[model samples]
Target: MSETADTLFSHVKPEQTGYVSGGLRDFFLYRDLGVAAATQGKVIAHLVKANMAPEKGTGWHRHEAEFQIVIMLKGWARFMYDDQETLVEAGDCVHQRPGIKHFLFDYSPDMEYLEIVSPADFKTIDVEPVCPIPDPTPWN
Candidate 1:
């Protein structure tokens, strides 16, 4: 491994990981994967869960980062990438370029995903809603 890689090694056990409030949605839980400290704030990784009411989501916003990616691990979510509605399900991945306005309108209760972004601490700028989003399906 390269010197940088060797210095940034990390091994995280699931059971030992803890979830905290997310950046955009307080209802979602986020699990840090020790990437921030490892990368010296160059990047960060988080496992996120949609544990809130179906009606509640991140709304319209954009990240102030150079790179951002999300890989769905379970369930699914509905988002508006600019003006296009996109459904991201399990085994799916999305690359959200910097400053790409999007709205997370709804999601399954069991939704889970891994999100990696450049710059450990990125800015989330809320924008005016640009589309009429559908209501989230009610969950049991």
Candidate 2:
């Protein structure tokens, strides 16, 4: 095997993960899975959780990565992918191609998901909302 390939391997247990305040937003938490280090910043794997409060979620934004995917692991979330509203629940998977406009409007208190993206650090460019959206339902 190539030395680069051999250097890019990671294994993480659920119990070994710890959540930290997501720098992008205060209403979310993130758990890194060592993918950045193993892949030499080529990829990042993380678990993201919605905090237990109703707040304007990640507004319309797009990633600067070449590839991105999200797999829901708990609860549900409502998102606006471009102009269409999408409901993502447990076991649902979403592949967000680079530059796809999306808005994460709201989510359940127990919402958690796995997100993998190319490049350990990706730029998120915020855009104006282009669709009518309902007021977020408060978390209990």
Candidate 3:
């Protein structure tokens, strides 16, 4: 965050936060943990949970940021980092190297994860697939 505001300590509680729509993915809900504001947009920390059954999933895309990571808190998710498929389960943490083309094609019903990315105002750009994307598992 080269051009960032002064950051302050933040203590956010569930009671003070609310999951809202209008995130990168419409299929998921995002709850800001107050980090972006506290950190003056240097970074953002939020909890994202499934809002609907997995269908198309997040298409192949990349973020224009210096750092990003996802920590699964419950359930599981199937992702393709380039040509390799990786299954992220509860307690798993994934560091998505900057500008890495990836796809989250499937996830459990109750899937929820904490995502932290540097520079709150990052950009998500759609990219051509690096490999064939797998169909999502049918929702029971």
Candidate 4:
């Protein structure tokens, strides 16, 4: 690695990962959202920003190895778990344990959220996408 390799804000293109879905068209994952400490071989922490339009969001999914904390940065969203739903808006945060089934719903046009995962290699977890919820609105 170069001298600045660990300090630079590297750009991660969306196409680099084969993980894509028709339901999350506006979402993208930035692997290098911030700089990592040289002492930590794995990222100490990382950010995942999801930009969603009205009624666009991620499908139900679970991570096997990574626990995640999500914070809504803009607009509004609904966090759906197996038996409960919580409305999360700007400044709201939610913690999701690893291996639990969960999903996010962006009901506004400018919905954006940040997912901070610790021990950043936690992202290597396998994400299994489940069936999406049907939209009540026509033409979705």
Question: Could you report the Cα RMSD, in angstroms, for every candidate shown?
Answer: 1.8, 1.7, 2.9, 7.2
lDDT (10s digit) by residue, model 2, range 1-140 = 44656356679887888899955678889998999889888888898998657577778888899999999999988988999999999999999979999988888989999999998789999888778776777865
> For each candidate, what TM-score against the reference?
0.92, 0.91, 0.95, 0.56
- Point out the higher-scoring one by TM-score: 1 or 2: 1
Candidate 3's residue-wise lDDT over 110-134, tens digit each?
Answer: 9999999999999999999999988
Deviation from native of the Cα of residue 48 in model 2, angstroms: 0.5
lDDT at position 86, candidate 1: 96
Ranking by TM-score: 3, 1, 2, 4
- Cα lDDT of candidate 4 equals 0.54
Model 3: residues >4 Å from true position, as ranges?
Answer: 1-5
Tell me, by lDDT, which candidate is best.
3
Error of 1 at 82 (Å): 0.5
Better of 1 and 2 by lDDT: 1
**What is the per-residue lDDT of model 4 for residues 45-118, given as tens digits with 9 covering 90 to 100?**
33344443435455666654455677777766666675466688889888877777766654544555666555
Which window of ten consecutive residues has the lowest lDDT sum in model 4?
16-25
How many steric clashes between backbone atoms does each model show? 0, 0, 0, 0
- Those runs of model 4 whose alpha carbons end farther than 4 Å from true positions after fitting are 1-31, 35-41, 44-56, 123-140
